[model samples]
Target chain A: MSTDSPIDATRPIALRAVRGFHVGGRPVDLVDLPHRQLATVPGLQPRVSNPNGRYQVGQLYVQQFALAAPTARYPLLMWHGGGMTGATWECTPDGRPGWHDYFMRKGYDTFVSDAVERGRASWAPACLVSEMPEHRTLEQAWDIFRFGPPEGYGAANGKRQAFQGQRFPVHALDQLAKQFVARWTSTGGMALDAYVELIRRVGPCTILAHSEGGRLAQHAALSVPELVKGLILVEPAGAPSTAVEDASRLRGIPHCVLWGDYIPQNSLWTIYRRQVDEWLAAVQHAGAEVTEFDLPAKGIRGNSHLPMMDDNNWLIANLIHEWISGAMEGGMSG
Target chain B: MSTDSPIDATRPIALRAVRGFHVGGRPVDLVDLPHRQLATVPGLQPRVSNPNGRYQVGQLYVQQFALAAPTARYPLLMWHGGGMTGATWECTPDGRPGWHDYFMRKGYDTFVSDAVERGRASWAPACLVSEMPEHRTLEQAWDIFRFGPPEGYGAANGKRQAFQGQRFPVHALDQLAKQFVARWTSTGGMALDAYVELIRRVGPCTILAHSEGGRLAQHAALSVPELVKGLILVEPAGAPSTAVEDASRLRGIPHCVLWGDYIPQNSLWTIYRRQVDEWLAAVQHAGAEVTEFDLPAKGIRGNSHLPMMDDNNWLIANLIHEWISGAMEGGMSG
Candidate 1:
């Protein structure tokens, strides 16, 4: 089922610029005197009193990939979902070019970020940071993401009972599984704060938020809708409870919610669907322009929840490109 | 991810038996008084109807592959979805060995049927047939099946937007399109009648049904539960609107409903999900051993609605084999 899809070879090679920065750093003192203990060393040494690393403020990490000869009308900013990092947009488990590269090829200045306390962002002491997410085991992810039978992925030995025609590269299940990280318990507010600050610094840009990142994206949009050129929600974790006033402010920003495969019979997904619906209706009532892409409605089947990592990730990237192009061009179309 | 999955190759090779037969045919009279016309080149060529073919009752066509050394406790009779024939189980659109061969290798005597008015079961005159489905356009199927964008499928030029991670053979989209036939508007009842008769003639057996075939499978089980040893519903289009009484009759049968990928945003599929839910609940309440495989819940992603044709189709087949083996061994288990 392979064909040489048309490639724009003549398109000018992308002139790329890359940089990194930190957001929302705060100061904190290290308490060492309380736990000091004597150590048997050649020289007199305060066992636990010595400072570990330079004491500084905690901040979120941001990586920017700017295309000098950009084709897109607006810069694109991406936020990762829970338990994930900026790597979410970098590459896929199947080793395909991730959304970041795909969009860059299409000539968009792209920025990906690690939320506060995630990835390159230095972790703060438990007291300094807000609620932290518990580490997720491989079993938990396999169950939560519906990878296969409760027995875990054994596709290698054919003990897997994965759905027929499932899109997740069963051959690469373990590779994809390796990407799942620990999710925070209640860092939404802090993440929201950092995201809004990031948006303020970045200026007006189109944002793509996946899963849990959706809450922060919504908060940022609601707080400063003027700076958000567009919002692309990929199977949002949940939407903020919004009033018409909050939503109306987002009228100028075009929004789209894209869902991947498998929602029926799964209670958790059902709830997510309802949340998306409520958000859609709420935003529409406020006169905000919104579009929903029910993949199945368009006869697109077999897309897993994490479409960006699916074998056909490039195809989805194309769809998103079209949507973003249309929205930025003053229309909301698929 | 490419680890060689374990295959029960050492299991005895099946002793196979092949047979063909017709089901539910009836007599029809030829009318000689109809309007007649003469042909210039022939001797009084009459326009009036004459006896056509051999005189036999119209019945569905059944092709059976019986294994002499059957490992499965009961025979497995398969019914294809709407607009399809027994070919649905024969081979995949991508040319891989399909479920029929896979299961036959597992030692299950398999029977595939072309429903009345479909495939080998030649259609009778309108007066003799019950109902016929309307022809579906390529556009309609493309839209309903989510093959790609509204622009339509053109694999030759690579103008397709199949869902990212879709398992469908995009390269074979055109080939698969060529196989789709017209469906009947109200042939469910007639097909059900013939299917029930087939079951009666073949004796008690397990059933594997997809899409529209769900109706006939359900009815056959409900009408004669004794004849249905086990039931495997693969993304059934809809299920029987069975009351507790109707469902209780199926208490002895172990039923499993396996949903493929992507069902959340599809409005049409929402209705289908509801129907499946209703059927599942009713059957469970009736003390029928039932199991629902929500693939997404198990992290088995990227499965299209047609698991049989998916890249991981054999994995799905293995799951069903386990379920059948468990059920036939005197108790229903996953």
Candidate 2:
């Protein structure tokens, strides 16, 4: 009953498919979830559970939403910023609030998984669709995604002080990203499988990430180039210059990374120069295909590391709507 | 009727447009064409000209076919390759045999204007378009498009000795393209204006250029980046690669360059490494918005330059259909 996504016009539809292997569990199948039954609401709220019990993948939880289209291509797997959880994207009861309604109406199967210790769905760790993507420990992963303190910042703060840690914040981001991608591929099927089955089932999926999650998306796309056709990042703190090199390696892969801050007072504005420089460099290498739009426009947010929620919610809704329309139109598997 | 266009479905549509200009002398508009009226003959041979001389421009002619859905956003403006006339595209009497028909049945307004000297609309003296593009030129107008010799193979044949005498082939091509675009824009505010005006009376407008014509389309797109929204090029030739330095020049613009080689002899395998090298290099600069796809396999003479008449014509026809369908459905505008 709310619109927190880019796609919000085609309501009352669902997009479902085999999400992943259920290995020792129920086969994972994701389906379009509606906002509210309107008359009979499905009590499916934020709930945390160890999808993988033995592994202390921290805490895991499932974030569900009704899909707008009956059929979908790729599922948009959302990864919230650091110190945030799935509940960060909430909708008003009237369906004027979250991304679920937006994408559902436009015809995509939407799902948001969260980790523990956040607002909602924090009782459990995020889904491991696979193993711990190569990193032996979570700290290393933290170092890769920029939520870790930037270089030159106090080493006393939560940050990686190893290996030329004296580098500039932007420079450090690239090296950190390399580490994450290296780990992701070494164990996460680097070139093992194309995850073709996943794509065939969902359609042509794209990863949506924010902040630290940006590091993960970058790794996955690079680790499994064949599987990722595109990427949609929101105010991502990607390696300022490294993305250009990273994007170059991607070749045919397309990308839309949004960042920039209208409000100079906002901390996000701090990395604006670095982010833009990196994006422009990537654009030079990849051309119009690898893009960075001026999406400084605010977007949907919740009680989390929120965007300018008030100025952005609708624009975010529009994005979801367009995404659904484009994806569902069929045959743009690229 | 014939299938050389996408203007009328039931009747064998003519490609003639109302051109106030002349060819050599007599009015460009035809009062009576040789093939406009013909009785049902024994063998079945209907010429591809129109009665109204208003369709001829310079050494060019016209062909039109009705689209399946009149609500099409853009009427496809088709320009054929070298040494080929409008008739070369047709297969059967009731139409549906050429690429032009495939698009029309799918609801796209179709029109084909002949090239000046059996090459492209912009060829030789009265060529329809040009292709040369340099940083200086781009800076002159911030060119969004350019046309010229398809990354050529003059080296193999030693065919180019002086670029038509001192004028680099690239420069000559771009100049032709520049003039063509100037005419189109000046006459109707961009080639799509008349087509769009006509279609708006009906719906939207797009473009489809084959072989040499493909180059013209590219040039047109560059001439008025804001005006031309989408393009479909058929086995285009002479796509000069933008050197690394040049690569830095092209920052914005979307391109959908469709390549096909139905014959194995004409396969991408046969494509020169030099051409590929430059293409890739330039693409590196272009980025992800461009979509490149391989066409069905065929032979050595399988390209747009001199596609073996008869069956190979399907290559262009199929491309046109897909291009129009692509533009109409995808609406790759801006």
Candidate 3:
């Protein structure tokens, strides 16, 4: 593995536009609330206010970075996982360019998103939401993100351990932790709706999703199969059950799933991997093109759940880009 | 007035980098807690999770877009007002180019920030925070943002009215509301600390801040007066009292304050405007160059609290840009 950063930080890139917008939420009306004072500043008197009228809730935020000239036929919509935002695709914790920059450099216009109720996609009031938001602790992130074994995160600095050959920058776990956000279990449907709305708005486009976002992308593709040109699932937490979903609908949408180094070691991932494998088999049975990359099997070692943030993230991005080119061409030929 | 959007949205720009990072937060240790299951999917079994460990809290997120060619000597830091993120400077709700796009095209490197506990800057647990978070209702926003009189936002579309000749796209008020996020009363100090840390990291810079953000920029300027080349405050909510802040320290920094229409009609802004006026007066008294633009007085009318998002936002941006050039030259000569 190379110790040097893959990206040159000072290099300039030509861009058509860097813009952002909100999509897919309806107004919810709040009526007849008693007047109250809300304290915004500690020393100042609380302002008397009314909590009434129409408020827009459940909208997703998308920030687009368009290359001057795109080689790919379709734009790429980058969706982040749970407890994370569009920042997942922006830059790695260790300051290297992540998938967004990598793919943009590869001549793809990228739309990175903050799903509904996450990041810049503001949340509704607690009463309107189905459940309270939950936060991810570092211990939980270490165990679940597969940085190391369940007990690898110890009390002291010296006690913390990464899985042998862990490609993730374990020392930068705190930096990754900074991107953790409070997510609600109830907003999955809202997020899926917003993502589908995004696909409709952008017309024909490919979706590259991570973890929780993968399932949302899967559903969005199924919802609007004609608009979704390709689906890239990176370490997805779960996939739609083959028995439940009509796999024939996804026949035109090429699918690619990428797995990192350690799956058998983690009990949770073991279950998730099995579920996805079954789902992919069902999709393939229905005559859809499906590609799977198990990193270790492919001789790419020591990768974590967040391969895009790994030391060899650029390499992984290149692999995905190559796969995308082949898949798009195959779709055209078929 | 021309109905055409002020910005040419299709233009391309050269950028050295479009990157994002987190700054200024300390790790908080979570003590012993019983293991529990977290429900992330509606139909699936909840996953067992550990809630004990170190968590990073109170950090701020900043995204930077650097121009390719040298022009401005210092970068511009854009801080959003309450209930908004860096998205405030990204694009107008009506799909017009925002301050970020305009300023970047004007040959300035721009760093737009999400303040602590807002937007990409995730909030701490309720237990860790001083007070519960609050959401702004459409009625509250209408009253405070001064789109019209307190009674302007009627329940029916036909009944609603914008103060005669309001420039804010009233039909798109819902669009603006989409950018609103839940904010905390207790996180002001944390936000200030993070803003100061950003100043230290970015070196000498001018700050362009809106509403509540204006106060934070003011304090950050006072904390590191030498690093803050200038301050552009748009409808600032509050300012440091002359009796408490040593205005002499601000003598070297040029200050610009801009106000929109209908302040007298909105009681709250009248008080806020007065405080900022006194603060600016005191700074000018202490020998700082101070410039104030009451838009109506300058023949720029029909603007609301968020002048940067108004229909004529580009015109206002150009005004600010010209002022910046003059201030920078004056600083050099003086």
Candidate 4:
């Protein structure tokens, strides 16, 4: 189960449709550049002046893969973590099928999304946006993603130490880095709004959100609890405090939180874990069914922050499938 | 056939696998900014210093959808135009099945790519890259994409004039604009190299390239003619001069160049059309089989630069499919 076997490339997938679209965001009128020359595309003669018009900004991009005969009652919406795109769920760094494929194969319609300001969810100009974009350096990703100890990356080969049982393909970390994107600091509110819009468009559905997207999923669920049938948060970077959200709104919605190994070792993740635990406790206190899986505790060891991209991703996916099946049944009975 | 009917959402698509990977690009070592505070992520206590390391740069991101059963001899590589990602081929602006789906349904393994410095192909830090990235404004897009004449956009309703027979869904222009990404001017060479690498990995295949991607596709074909089985250039924005590339290298390859309506009215497109025509003449002169489609002349009218995203996109896709089938057959016989 912990092996690095690749997905069978020849396995057939009976898909009903594969399509994509942009959702949410509002149009903003650009009136300031009345006569500004259009020089974006290189080498255009008789430069045309910028026209004052309405332009869309801060939208989300979603790619959907519908199954021919879906067994699951609800669709699965996959939201990637910070500095990543829907590509995160499309394939693993080591070139295996990602969670998007696994769930689709499980006979659930899958919608993988790139949140606002990331990937196909194109960004607004600096003037239109509230803050400048930020990029994650390789050094930062290696450390924050918990592939190794803070000092493991950029260290001498002998000194480099992946958490003893780290399952991330460290050799393919560069490939993983290729999925990182420039994100904005001020788009949290905008992103949350878009997620809610997404749920409105394709819900009541289950949301499988990772890292930064986790908080947005939680907020969206809270905002439209009826539409969000279930929630799965994996190594979420932040969480909504009970003081801020009415956790009781999630009373009937099932919740699952997953954490990989080496969390306690990272200071930032330690804080994040504590925050999420507090929120989960509040949700549980309010009568929501909460299931937590500390992978090491579950004997599924060697997982990195991005367990979906780890060597044993399918094993993890199988576990989640079981949880979803059980959770749906339990919700039905309750 | 030119109707605005949406794709039948429940149509089945059998696939072997859906996955993605990054290709090409060399590692860049960052020697500067040692001990720089890792402040990319906001609000992390005890800021860690940035670790200097080797980072991958200038790679292309490719998403592949392999079919369970294949009738075609080679795959179809879909490379989008400037300011756009592989999303261009995923779904049309008006939410119809794009060329990717059409080609895939026709039994060809399709690889839709986001070139270097675009979409999932991450960008480098300012220090690592040669130049700044450029954003396409809505005004420029409206004119250059040839939806209408220069004064057509931003004019009063009555004053705005779409080409009398424009077929692009003007109402959904904003949705199309949402797919536009910030692109770098200096990455053309890097993009070309990455595309060539992609060809090496999935070669003996056909390339369906649009706009800016057209130049890169031609260059890759010239660089490795044997690998490129066929070529489809859709309203390509630029072309390699015969002086720069020996078009005779494409001697045995089958080529198809498609143009939409209203090319004669736009000055910039006129130049691009002329350049591409020159290259096509040279390619044909070299004993290569070449087919050119002027949609209007062929009775398929009311198209735009992005014919793949136009209202009558299905008709255009049908034309390309017929051309591909004929070209492949011709290649085998000739």
Candidate 5:
């Protein structure tokens, strides 16, 4: 549609109202230390813990984009993947207006949230100490996600080659690379629990989950189905197992599984797809309406693991808008 | 490097000089019909074949972008893939300046050409009669290239899903879909032969070939090594075989094989990579300065098969420029 010039028109127009807030934080006891006494000691350099060490855990950071006249029955909530923040939906790595604003423009109140200990949800020392986490380097992402040539970087060799039709903006790769934060192995459960709580407070709504956020979405939907009306899963890292009881509880609720290009070659993604398929099958058998969206089948190409942050993200957003509108038109409780 | 704003700065500046011309065309006799008799007939108006019909089997079309003070010692000849015109190197599908302009800006005389029976090289009836060809549908590309979800299009399903990280410009997808020309199975050999001839005429240049264009580049390099100073292969469809004789002839020749992302998942590309590896092995054994660029290895991600028309095409062009300059600095003979 943008033939004369290539520009990102995905940014949402200024909404009637926008707000930011914190959700689901629990208070912690203060830690008292001999700060003055330690400082008085001559030779040894004194270190003191903050006198107000009282902190919050399981709290999340959320930014809401509200439309004055909502078109949909329920607000759309966006949950980010692991080691990421609410920023995932705020603006694209390429600096385009992200899904948060796009969905807002579509007349749906949009809520973007960062999970416990990620992004704006500052983590407590207890949560961080549970397991040592590692930061993912840009090189690791390049290879794992099949972004470009698999080798050659460092002073000896310059930047490696990117894949031929990758949708992620390689020009802004450095900016995107900075978004990969340290992730912990034990944080999934905590994040999911917090997300479920957030859903309860927000009331019934449609949820869009990506990667690790899939777990939270699934858990919340199952644990409190009353709060969730629909599910849009974009390459979820894991899916609800057949072992999940009362799959029928999700009956009548619309669920769509979205897959991008290059899934077969990615072992991890293949496994994830298998799990998702199995889960979707179980849900279907349980009488829930399950739809599978294979991007390649629809004539869309060259998408990576992070479709929301991709260059063609607007197209994906359009697709989501249509699906969401259709689902909500039937009534949010359907 | 562009962090403040994400803009495609790949567009080329107005060149100091530019020109276009046709190569490898020959005279053909025009068919003459009995004008009076043909006009008398209603439905079957005229049908006559010239007794002296002379046709050119393999001619091509070329456009050259020249710089007054070229930095590189040799010119860069760009050969497009199957069913594609020289436009592949002219501008990106996302509206960025393509490799043709990018390399020209780097101070090299760049030549982009259409192969026999492709684009500007209109084919004769004889070529068409050689074999039946099939036009690639958007559906086929969506699946084969791993562009989008592998299912859902047409009336049955209104829209399809895009892959997560695909880099192809989805907004311009319909426009790009129109670019998929019908490809004949039997035309490969003809195109390769014509390309080799073109190389001989051009003399001492660097060839940048993509996908199907790789075959022509390899054939030309092997048949007439003297004309080729350096080789830059960008995701060539096929690689050389072990059967190559006198492999040492390419010894000391600077050859760089650049691969984009998302190859492992695509079967055809996987096979292509294997073959390319075999050829690279042989080339190395023969002592050529062979450089393999695995984009993912270098931390570049989300590339599709058509890097030249991708969003980061300028980056790929920049890489080619560096390699060419380095190769030329050591002497074009290498």
Candidate 6:
């Protein structure tokens, strides 16, 4: 179902639609395309997307678009937290203006992508494990490149570790670690030397993450240091933990944190403390400025986890704009 | 099935248990208990009710327990915000020691209740016309003095009001004004002196509200000033169209303003000009001291309408205790 390194023809056609740039504000069609494609609904307005250049790279499929004026040199790729698809960025629950416009007007071309391990991936986990032949469960989701499906769960044999209700036999972290290792192994495990090469190829960008996607952002940052300049995370689920120590060592890259007052702590909350501690230490280690934010309380449909979708989310919009301005401007002084 | 006044005797008994200072440190039994309804799963721990007393007069059905000191005036009420019934206060979502024990040791008696309103009489709407007496449609829940169902809904021939989402065929104010007229007519069209006499019987107490309930609280204040003393609303919602002029002209009582941020034109995000022209003027007219609180943003949930339920909700708890503690402390300095 998947071919490594072979380009998909759809990438160019999508790219053309995005490049057209509706100066007159022509109606752009973001029709919920197949396999996690976004579409424009009647009551819903389209926020942002790049049909072109937005292509699938191996297992990971990404949608990228260039933002309008006041553009930043580094691109911004926004991701949905876990249990949420990229569509979360496209429409309000009741079908209204997506936050995509907020970033675009501010001049950051945004990209929302799917994590390669689940959901719309064409290859099933069963099939995916076949290639590298060592993956199992949500944990093995990370190991396609380095080890086979962790011990017992792997085709004939891969170790299994399941905690909570996770169907995966391995620890989520263990799987993630092995997956990164697999990716490294596939590329000859050159570590930073090759990671820097990929970073340069992917170009410069900052990550805007929510919920579980925050964890992915942390991993991406740790794996590829030079590619990232800053991180704008909103109530990211799993963060900083021990990973924060690694993330902080990346040197002067700024980290902005926005957490909700009533937000329930999960792995994310744990990460918040870890990341902040790591950051404080990281700054001490690297001698960089650290910025942190705590969002005031508000209920979105009586639920407190999803902040961007809060009925009274205008505060966040202002804060985002301010944070971006501070970040873009602060870079000069730093 | 319900009657007016506090029917504590006939109602079932309810107990609130915490992890540290439980009944012999054993779990609580919450069956057929007089006001102690388990809105959540039985095995789950009980949390404190709102300290700010927002979100459905949440404090009304509290289960009070003795503190370690046995002689504390202001007992701490553990409140969990939306979604969570009240278990959130005892332990973090992942189950760890929360604020209850921390405060109990500090010599504060603790109380616990649920913010959920489906079963509470306090949440019943103030003014809806309906044939059937459902929970809070519009009609006063009961003739409180009579301790029986009111004449309108109880009567088989009662006229019903239409429910059109947030819209209504009748304006609440106009309806209230008409009720004033009808109530007057039914009472032989009494004069202003008689009206004042009737309202005085309504008695004294303060109301605190959050989110949508805030609008209702304001309406209650505007309509029945005799029944309220210094309204303490936490982000109440109301239309400026009807409330502005009246609120501005109002006099005597204090209004406390607590909001995170303000964006132009949003009903939630009123401009300063509007605030001065409308709300602040009303507060001045009422002659109330206005205390503005901009709480810390971190760990804040989507429940902004409910500042009293934050993890650090003691912020407002202390504020409330300040007001409540007044007469008890120095016998009215004013």
Choose the strongest candidate by DockQ.
Answer: 3
Model 1, global lDDT: 0.63
Q: What are the Cα lDDT values of the candidates? A: 0.63, 0.36, 0.85, 0.81, 0.62, 0.35
What TM-score does model 4 score on chain A?
0.92
Better of 5 and 6 by lDDT: 5
lDDT per residue (tens digit) for residues B1-334 in model 4: 3563334434577888888788988777777665643343334453545435656787899988888886677888999998789999988877778888777777788999998988878777666765445567677787788888777875776455688888888878778888888777656778889999999998689899999898789988888899998999999887888776788999888889999988888888898888889989999999988899988898988899999888788778877777877766543210
Interface RMSD of 4: 3.2
Worst 10 residues of 3 chain B by lDDT: B1-10
Output the TM-score of candidate 4. Answer: 0.93
User: Which runs of model 1 end up more than 4 angstroms from their true locations?
Assistant: A1-13, A32-58, A129-132, A149-158, A243-245, A331-334, B1-334
The alpha-carbon lDDT assigned to residue A282 of candidate 1 equals 77
Candidate with best lDDT: 3
Sum up the clashes in candidate 2: 110
Displacement of residue A129 (Cα, Å) in model 3 is 1.6
Give the per-residue lDDT of model 4 (tens digit) for A127-245: 67654455676777877898887677857864456788888888787788777787776568888898899999996899999998887888888899998878999888878877767
| Model 4 / residue A107 / CA error / Å | 0.9
Interface RMSD of 3: 1.7
Q: Write the residue-wise lDDT of candidate 3 on A1-334 in tens digits.
A: 3344444545677788888889999999877666666777534578865666667887999998888878787899999999899999877999877888777766788899999988899888766775667789988888889999866787366667889999899888888989988888767888898898999999999899999999888888889999998899999888888778888889888899999988888988898888889888888888889999899999999999999999899889877887888876542210
* TM-scores vs. true structure, each candidate: 0.46, 0.30, 0.96, 0.93, 0.46, 0.32
Model 6 has an lDDT value of 0.35
* Stretches > 4 Å off in candidate 5: A1-16, A30-47, A50-53, A126-128, A152-157, A331-334, B1-334
Better of 1 and 3 by DockQ: 3
lDDT of 5 at A201: 77
RMSD for all candidates, in order, please.
Answer: 30.1, 30.9, 2.5, 3.3, 27.4, 26.0
